[model samples]
Target: MNGSAGAIEGCYWQADRETREVSPALSGDIKVDVAVIGGGFTGLAAAYHLKVADPGLEIAILEAETAGFGASGRNAGFVMTLFGASVSMMKALHGKERVRQAHQYMVSAISALEAMIGEHAIDCDYERTGFLKIATAPAYISLIQDEIELFQSLGIEGFEWLDRDQLAARIRSPVFLGASWEPGCGLLNPVKWLNALRRLACANGARLFEGTRVSEVQRENGRYRLTCDH
Candidate 1:
């Protein structure tokens, strides 16, 4: 594929806007206190948080392409509290307490994200429209009920079972039998949110290098050295 093809191919988010200017690649050896591999949501958020915690820490984010060029820019932006495969699966695998903790963490994370967006004035078209895990079959109704019951059992509120009529009132969908409605959920434009994060990380003194692919990393005299493609 040619340059810009990856950005245009599968990412509707990137394709919707004008092409973004990529940051310059690494030209020579550089040193930093921390070297972040990718420039996706996780990396950008980590860099931002680290800088906020310690403004003197030197951080660098190296990305193969531009920031948000990967799944960060190309995902259905559903900011819900569903961890792992399902609530039941999480409970089965990690027990009830862990599931509850996970749910609470996700809730806190969503709230923090919303607060950050407001504080930074990030224009990502964020909307707390809630989430609906709709049940299309009668059997799935029982599953939804079980999930809601599990949430209640775990002391996790903000979730309710919406019957067919109630769900239809919210959304005129004939195929939906019922849905697990979580009022704390939200949606946003992923690419826009990522771009905002990129800007915030840079503004907070996080150096970001696009088109810089890390080829190898080695420990040298108790410190780390990264080799990147030229």
Candidate 2:
């Protein structure tokens, strides 16, 4: 996994990050059923889920630096029920039904994240206060309406159009024309969240290596040999 030149550093999220006992660097060669090449949100989440499903599975997560030393630790912690782009844009690309399914999946993901937090007792200050997608331009009203209609077609309900007056009642914004509010979204402390997940992964038999960089993974006899720097 020659993905980077060296270990990445923690950005602004370090202020919110909780200190913990650190894992040692990779020194000698080792083998496992699975070797995750990164220690960010993606890698740790994969390890945690895999171990949960199959407790006996041997897994290891390798990080160039400490876990959450990349974008995963540095991101704004909004667990939004959004599909990256707006519902209208998604409907235009993949049509109504497909976009609806995609949107529904994101909604489900919000709850799943909540459940996972409680399940592991990961206290990252999670809040299900929901999300608001607002439109400042008058022309954007039609697009916001399209979002509501798209969800209605999916037999799903929870989205509502909030006029400027209604929006201001919640958040006082000067340029807001209208907005779409969904109640299933959330926010959290990203660094704390990742660390909790990492702890769970470790407790579930997923070995973690910090300050260890894997430069390549070579396949030999159907087994992977990870080249590393301790």
Candidate 3:
């Protein structure tokens, strides 16, 4: 596995993390029931869940570099319930019902993440600090108010409008006009969470390979063969 410092140098999350052992690269041909490309959050979670569902299943995660060395570790790390750009935008694009369902799905996803962190006792510096959508100009105040009304029409709770004074109390900024506050929001360290997922997936019998790039994939007979540059 490529645990080299250069792989994690640019990302703040990965750079801040403590050094750990990296898994070895794939050596020679190997066979598995499932081959998951990329060792990011999605791949690791899929491997872990698949093993949980069926312990006998064989799974291997292939990564070009070390895990969490991509955007998975460099994101803003906001565990928010917002879907897409805005509620108004989503409703206009997918209609009211679909937007409501999407919002609900995001809410459920945040809940599931919290549950997983608690269940596994993952230390990721998680904080339920909530979210604030601030309006820096007078024109944006109406836009934010319209979004709040849209949320209300969709029967969504927990979102409220904070006037200039109220917002000032929370954050002392003169440029801010007003803001929308939602209680169902959180922040965490992305790289730490990724590392925890990697550990859990490995413990659940998922094999991970680093510095192993897949060059080609083809079907031979009834099985799929992956060509890699180790």
Candidate 4:
């Protein structure tokens, strides 16, 4: 399967074999602590987490294509800054101090991801080149400025507000009216990242079966039976 997202060009991982289109379904019954459905990040993460949580537990990953042959392989590798709820919502949900803590967690996650990459020696080409959020209208400037203030108030550094000239100087784009830059965000080849995770999963004693598709999974007498059709 070609896992490249809409505009991103390139596969998600390296292939050690030819692309023989095959959907060899599971044939026999298997048992495990968790039965993951997809081979994307969620599934892979689950498998990895489970293995780390308990090495004795059986973990299996059934992939229809090679590892990282899904959306996990084709994504804009942006560890997005903590921007989900508005500042108002953050204040409402947990107040200012808690909101700052939550933001810290987001930054922590990025650091954790980098640490994972280094600890496992997963060569996915990760970098902390920072991130830019551009505004297309003057109305958004207020919101952007508010964010900058919040960052400064919370002692979050490396965030800068870019005016028209600054924005133009940083990015040669005529559409943006202004922009917010953070030094904590960057991009990477997701395909390579996924592949590296797969390798780590294998090294950690997790069995990954590529080109294996699970057609039917039914519980029978407290045991799950998986049927594979190729």
Candidate 5:
């Protein structure tokens, strides 16, 4: 690390094409049916969907920086199905039924996202490269095997186990003893995708404000009042 992490570029997603579109800052007070607090993936997705669901709905997104300046812009572009830990971990905490539901939900989310991108003709680099949860040590091999067993026991499709040779065929790595391969995954440029989503939201009639930092949010008479630095 030659330079400070903060000083380094947020991500390589923006390297190919620097500078996407940016919205203007909030100038004065305004009102809307819905006021979204951030311009990242969650906020932009909400604004986009709300407009699509009800074309007449009024929605606004407020952000202190550009649309993709937050966490959504800086993540490694891997749209994966697993979250936090293995499927067995999910079953332990939330039970087998809940795990099934959650897994289905996440899988559907990826599908919906891909559909959205396709429908909107977003040109963000999206590769259908499924992810592999590889085991680095011998101890982890048993963990991977157990995860595969859980996947089978739960009748979860699209998940399979790969032996060392099979794993090497996909990704040549000396440390990989085995790996769990799931087809429900993809690679993408998150920042580029965010910018495209921002543009799409704007085109769908969602008002976006940039460089407007929200300092406090309060509920006043059943409505939210947001104090900000505009």
Candidate 6:
């Protein structure tokens, strides 16, 4: 890639023509019932949800950079339900029912994203092509099978285990022992989705700041105070 290669790389949450602009910096001191630190998905999601739950609630978000500058925007946008934590690990940590609920939560987050896309009419190239996790070795086959069984026991369905022949038809990787395809997973442009969300949130009365960094967070007199570095 050339140093001066292209126009600014696209971001999922940069203010767009149709979207109202979020303030890029915080000015003088302000007071709010709740002050959230960090501007990524969790912070923004919390702020948005808080306001949605009760619009009269006072909420503020302190972001260190443009909202999507963190892991939320830099990610490849594969929202996975069966990607990270293993079933055994979760069951050990939170028991089977809680783990299952946790898995459902992750899946629900994806569903929420889809719902937001529809409600806001965000044109972020979102799709539900489904995500495939392929096992690259024979030794890993059992692990894949185990996950399938766990999903089944939880009353989750539509996860298919593809054998070598079936895998070869879609992916040319020769070393893949098999693949597991989950029907409800897929990818999207993270930047587009985020920007659209930022816009929608702002329209619905959420204040977002870009190019601002938070230096410290403190609780004072039963309220959270966020100090920004400007």
What are the models' TM-scores? 0.95, 0.87, 0.93, 0.73, 0.92, 0.83
Model 6 agreement with the true structure over 1-230: per-residue lDDT tens digits: 12221112454344342433445567777777767776677777777778888888777677665666678767777867863468777777777778777778878988998998888788888889787778987778889888888778877676899888988888877788788888788688776766665666566677765555778777778766677875
Q: Model-by-model lDDT, in order?
A: 0.88, 0.82, 0.89, 0.71, 0.83, 0.71
Instruction: Please write out the lDDT profile of model 1 over residues 1-230, one tens digit for every residue.
Output: 23443354567776677666677778898889999999999999999999999999999999988788788988999888877998888889999899888988999999999999999989998999999999999999998899888889888899899999999999987798989998899999898899889989999999998889999989989999899998
Local accuracy of candidate 4 as per-residue lDDT tens digits, 1-230: 44322222354333332243333335566666667766777787778877888888777888766666577866677776666677667777777788777778888878878888888877777887788878888888878988888778877676899898988987877778888998888677676676667666766777776667778888888878776555
Give the clashing pairs for model 3.
none
Candidate 6 total steric clashes: 7
Please identify which of the two predictions, 2 or 5, would achieve the higher lDDT against the true structure.
5
Extract clashing residue pairs from model 1. none
Candidate 2 lands at a TM-score of 0.87
The TM-score of candidate 4 is 0.73
Q: In candidate 5, what residue range of length 10 has the lowest lDDT sum?
A: 1-10
How many residue pairs in model 4 have overlapping backbones? 5
lDDT of candidate 3 over 1-230, digit per residue (tens): 33544247667776655677778889888889999999999999999999999999999999888888778878999999876887878888899999888889989999999999999999999999999999999999999999899999998888899999999999988899999999899999998899999999999999999888889989999888999896
Q: Supply the global lDDT for candidate 4.
A: 0.71
lDDT of 5 by residue, 39-154 (tens): 88999999999999999988989987767778888899899887657677778888888888888888998999899889888888898899898999999999888888887788
Q: Is candidate 2 or candidate 6 better by lDDT?
A: 2
Task: Write the number of the candidate with greater lDDT, choosing between 1 and 2.
Answer: 1
Query: If the candidates were sorted by their TM-score against the true structure, best first, what order would they fall in?
Result: 1, 3, 5, 2, 6, 4
**Clash totals for all candidate models:** 0, 0, 0, 5, 0, 7
Model 2 Cα lDDT, one tens digit per residue, 132-197:
888989878888888687778767688999999999999997999889998778889888888888
Better of 1 and 3 by lDDT: 3
